[model samples]
Target: MIWQLDLIILVLVIVCAIAAINVKDLLSAAILLGAYSFLLCLLWAIMGAVDVAFTEATVGAGVSTVFCVSAVFHTTRRTTD
Candidate 1:
């Protein structure tokens, strides 16, 4: 695995995480978190951690994101700040 590629992925993951935190919309933040998980999964795969990557894909990206969205659906989307 190329360190340059790993660095790129790390940068992307950081960016997505920050974006997810800063975004006021709950659904959008959840989606961004999913994207961050996806990039982390890719990084793990490239580092030869296939099992960990699969877990991230399924649990982090799939289940958690879905749960977040569902929770958002049941809550108000208004931004008070």
Candidate 2:
């Protein structure tokens, strides 16, 4: 049962990571990255590493994502040819 949940979360993390890299829109990529970070935090929490999970949730998913989105907002969303 627990392994199934871990597998699902792992798959989602991989998908988010791939989407984050392939996304054309900066905002979308930033959001995907945040999702990936959140999934990682969840994975850590599930693995019983509360300290790491909290740090990743606060730093990776929270602060880093906010910074990325802010940068995206201030700059161009589209990539130049």
Candidate 3:
């Protein structure tokens, strides 16, 4: 509920989002996106949206991250970037 905490979480979320977008490695990007969603889940929980936070944690941060990492591993091509 504290404004300071909310602001910190918001900053972290923004940084993670930006880092994910900028990173060339697929695995790193996936991890960053997972961190970003988890941060959003924290923000939601702080705002008293427990259900939304749970869904974000389970689907956004959890399943999607796993899928992304698996897909990255399955790719035979390496980053040319």
Best by lDDT: 2
* lDDT tens readout by residue for model 1, 1-81: 889999999999999999988888878888999999999999999999999999999998899999988988999665543
lDDT of 2 by residue, 1-81 (tens): 278889999999999989898988889999999999999999998899999999999998999999999999998899642
Q: Which residue segments of model 3 deviate by more than 4 Å?
A: none
Q: Tell me the lDDT of model 1 at 34.
A: 90
Write candidate 3's Cα lDDT for 1-81 as tens digits: 889999999999999999988887888888999999999999999999999999999999999999999999898325654
User: lDDT of all the models against the reference?
Assistant: 0.91, 0.92, 0.91
Best by TM-score: 1
* Candidate ranking (lDDT, best to worst): 2, 1, 3
Error of 2 at 32 (Å): 0.6
Q: List the residue pairs that clash in candidate 2.
A: none
lDDT of 2 at 26: 89
Q: Indicate the TM-score of model 2.
A: 0.92
Model 1 TM-score is: 0.93
Rank order (by TM-score, best first)? 1, 2, 3
Cα-based RMSD of the predictions, in order? 1.1, 1.7, 1.5
